[model samples]
Target: MIASSARLARAAGGSRNWLLGVLRGSSYGTASEASFQVESYKLHKLEQGPSTSVTLSRDDGLKMYRQMQTVRRMETMAGNLYKSKIIRGFCHLYSGQEAVCVGMENAMTPDDSVITAYRAHGWTFMRGVSVQGVLSELTGRVSGCAKGKGGSMHMYGHNFYGGNGIVGAQVPLGAGIAFASKYRGEEAICVTLYGDGAANQGQLYETFNMAKLWNLPCIFVCENNGYGMGTSVDRASASTAYYTRGDYVPGLWIDGMDVLAMREGTRFAKDYALKNGPILIEAVTYRYSGHSMSDPGTSYRPRSEIQEVREKRDPITNFRERLLSSGLATEEELKKIDTEVRKEVETAAEKAKTDQELPLEELYNNIYVDPPQGMKIRGCDPTIMASTR
Candidate 1:
């Protein structure tokens, strides 16, 4: 009977350990910094480009992994919320394109400016906005970064210009920000991003010409995600080589699926732009979800193609494997990080869902940085005026 009791006790102990493993995740050991070679970059109008070698410390690797995971999870949650009708209006999901923002932000400083098109949620988060802030903005909650006014497309952070809703409109504005940095005698550079869809805009060419003429320290990025909305890039663009489209401006075609590559290429681009003038970078990424919530994303492209890219070229998964293979992180450690990120996103999402909307009186409050006492702003009806006091 004593032996039977001993066996039962051991079994119970084993079960408890298993449960603990499930919750806390096991750690193998502390990972150290290491250098690994990344893919070579495709250059445009340049003699050379960024080095392929990249150094990865444990801290940076873990941070990048956690960030990419957080964005992915947050986007997934946003999609769910949108589907449930909790988030109204246009909602763009940045699932497969996590590496672009994460990688570029890692290479940039807080003083550097960024502006992008309507697909700005991930960029907003990378620019230092919290998950709750992004979700709340999507939910139109009072606690959002924009006081729930900007919604999905117009969220902003410090030195990080808000996403512009108009296609290709932000490029010229980004140049202006770069011009401001130069004017102020600051070392800051502006990173302006737009999608492949906006590549054909005439305003872009005009902006490019002016930026080159002024030698503006701006990095114009084209996030070529294969398709422009439901239409394939090939069908829409006369020249699919977006990086080389900027004839006078130097460009780099980066593997947007590789975060490390993105970082290195961006680092090079920033330095080159600071020294020379405006440059272009085509981040050849893929979007897993539809253009907005409205697009199925698979109608034009085959579902098999999307699945293939997810399985083969997914940025998060590829980076995870790179970390493990480089001995930068163990599976257990990554799992633990994943658990934390998932919980953080889930918690933020819950708060976003429950947060209150701004009071109607605040509609015209922020129209001006400083409004005169008893300032009145026109409402939807020209005859109606709203008090800004």
Candidate 2:
């Protein structure tokens, strides 16, 4: 049975099965010796990202496959919830950007911090929030992380800052978080991410200036999905090279669709930030859906264009093929993983439906830091009144 193999992969072979062992739970790690290697990589103006033969063990490969599928399934469920009038207001799906999150999260230690723009369900799950927690939050359930208050743009956690609503606002907050880590003498670095749309925001430049001056351990990430809302990257910005925006900070550009490349890019950037101040990375990713729930996502770009990318570079399919071809996992093993992930998502959705929606007065709590991790409400509510909690 595939389940038996998964169990064996985790239980048998001890240290040799390090990554597989870790895969039994929420965490994962890469082997010291790569079971496979990344043949190529993407970089900024220069090739600063990992171009060497980096090891990617079978266990690690399976872990990434599961992670990407989980995110995709979660986002798919979110979209359905939005259509059914459950999740509302400013819902941005990260269905196509799984590799970036999975790769980047796997490359770092638990101490590292991350902050991103509104598209954050994947990152929230990667940072340890459960499918139930994420779905409950989006559904405005009392059990939701942020207690059903933060909704789509305000999820937060231990080392994860938030699903910031402002376009480029999280960039400065990320720098501040890195500054705090540095002030406390912690070795953690902060990864702040924005989309190609927010790449040109004036505050982002200001954050870059301050981060460079203070040598803050911040990794500024530009998830350049080639479109800012409905506008193409070239038309939206004078220069589409987001990595070079941080003139003083060193930069790397990489293929965001490839999870392995993402892992190498983040690993290299994390080390560069800890030792050499801040760094910049523009991950060339794509989003299969509209900018938000309201946008059809087909107005600006041709359907064929998006279809071509899906056919050629869909991150999940690409990684899945690599795993199969490389003999890292069997077809049945992968099917089991997909089945398991689907069941998890469906179970989470059903449970989310039963969760009690937060009351109007629940907003009074968590005005400030009186209590850590306040409640959140799904944006479906038609009205809200403020109170001190």
Candidate 3:
């Protein structure tokens, strides 16, 4: 390039020619550097951790961007479905927390298991459950992961424990799973997730002690999504450092909005837990929607807060920017991905609408492994009890 510039300068008789040479060589783009050049994007509010190397190659960047977009689109559709009365019971949309689930899932191996509390739509999708099944579950259709039984709070998959409803209840169950994995001499690590609200529960600390004592391979993920239901973390908890909530257990705090960072943090935690027992991850993230369908998300928090996060820290947008900056993809390509994801989610919803709801007998059968002669439980309607005689 320099030699060519010199020859052009001589041919054009000086500075005017040199300027032309430079202008011709440089492409008009946001970044002056080569499109494929890797750039450093800083992690936000990472309070603590031993850092891990992240190579956001073109394939990885685009893939993660696509996954996060899918989760966001899925949650948006779920919210719409809920407002339309298609999704009944309690429904918690995991819109802004897409990075946490997608990153964690990416870091997980086939043997690694996962269990989280109610906000579990994204996790269920990542665990090999089809989008159709997830939507069907939300729509209370039999095609759901649990055949319409679990709904949003109880979908299950291979090596995935559940969408447990009770607060902090899944923690010990996760420990039990890790223990079982150890007993079988399997190298599986269990990732147990709960919210900041559940962080204050005594059961979590109890499980932490047992897990540390037994040296179980467990990654206790505290998804600190700013609020515990209607109350902010500061309003609810005495201390907000969820990572350190498990006293003796080592903890790492990461910017949960960054998918690459989340993936690296989870990977480290999983590896550390396998040999050194339990570790905790306080993934600082935010949720775009209300705690559930019952709560209007804007009451406790200002709408501006959500808007700011959406504009500035949106995981999907941030990842997309990285891809564009690195020349991994053009703006058109990313938009195309978004367009495809939105359509895919919409199609799943359409298909889910046609699924058959579980019959009333299903209520009585799943409750007991062996149905007694006089088994009776509340059917589809609580006012009318159905008998399994």
Candidate 4:
């Protein structure tokens, strides 16, 4: 009886040990595994509640609010124009990602240069292009910043380079701009914006190496909106942490939905680049529109997913809430700004729709600084050229 009781007790103890081992798995087998689990839990908590407070003055807050509103309204108007067939040829609206551009613009100096991909209406607006000019560009009118030549994907303004179409192509051009700024010894920085899809290109790393080697004053920003066209970042990129792409260059990751967070983060990056050469910043934002107007935006992502980001993580709405909570703005003040922006956008759209287009003769005029003396231009009836001349 004594032997039987001792054997039973031993069996029960072994069973308990086996259960504990199953519950713990590899977590308790090694110190490193335990430490990793704890670190991951802490990071998850940080993501849930990011530190997003800012100390902007009332005026600055109001200005940022207005800037964000302008971007939203402008993109909305562009969408309408595209539907009505007023704007033609590849219209990409920057509706949901306004905060990344507006907040970064607020932190930049007038002399600083900015460049981005085809989804560029927001940055152009933030870079001092008027609503009328943007709309006119979309409509291909004579009053466009590109003089009715380059359409939506090629608009430009003072100190703004371009709305490049080629993916990952703008990095080297932006580096050249930075090189020029450094060569001239100007207190200016170049901000190069690209999508997560473009992050996988070979040239991006080459640009990074060159930028770091020469210590160019360039801030390479990756707007990781989670999707590269239809492919999710996870599918397209092996490493989704784009801020660390610079490797040698210091990196920053910010909640792109928070205007203040983006503003502060961009300011820090700009200052760092100015003082210590180059830096990389990754803004984790989302795009509400399809990759282009042709897409329905439903193949890879669901409507509910898009709606959640719009409702809860919209940069414009988020900014308004923060401003009101901090006493930086009142509902009445916000409403007044909204009313003015609506009027401005409406007027610009009307002008864009009615504006005159560039004449055919002007098409080949700006291709070169001076036309070649004896160039046989194809499709040019000699009679027509002579008549025009």
lDDT of 4 by residue, 251-353 (tens): 7777676676787777777877888788888888899999999887899999999987876677888667555544455688899999999999999999899
What's model 3's TM-score?
0.83
Ranking of candidates on lDDT, top first: 1, 2, 3, 4
Top-scoring candidate (TM-score): 1
Candidate 1 vs candidate 4: the TM-score winner is 1
Query: Evaluated with lDDT, which candidate comes out highest?
Result: 1
Q: What is the lDDT of residue 210 in candidate 4?
A: 97
Candidate 1: regions farther than 4 A off: 1-29, 372-375, 378-389
- C-alpha RMSD for every candidate: 10.0, 8.5, 9.4, 15.2
| Window of ten residues with lowest summed lDDT in model 1 | 1-10
- lDDT for each of the candidates? 0.85, 0.81, 0.78, 0.77
Candidate 4, run of 10 with poorest lDDT: 33-42
Q: Compared with the true structure, what per-residue lDDT tens digits does model 1 show for residues 233-352?
A: 989988999999999999899888889889999999999999999999999999999999999887899999898788777889877866765556788999999999999999999999
Model 2 alpha-carbon miss at residue 110, Å? 1.5
Alpha carbon deviation, residue 156, candidate 2 (Å): 1.3
Give, for candidate 3, the lowest lDDT window spanning 10 residues: 12-21
Of 1 and 3, the candidate ranking higher by lDDT? 1
Measured on C-alpha atoms, candidate 1 has an lDDT of 0.85
Candidate 3 off by > 4 Å: 1-49, 367-389
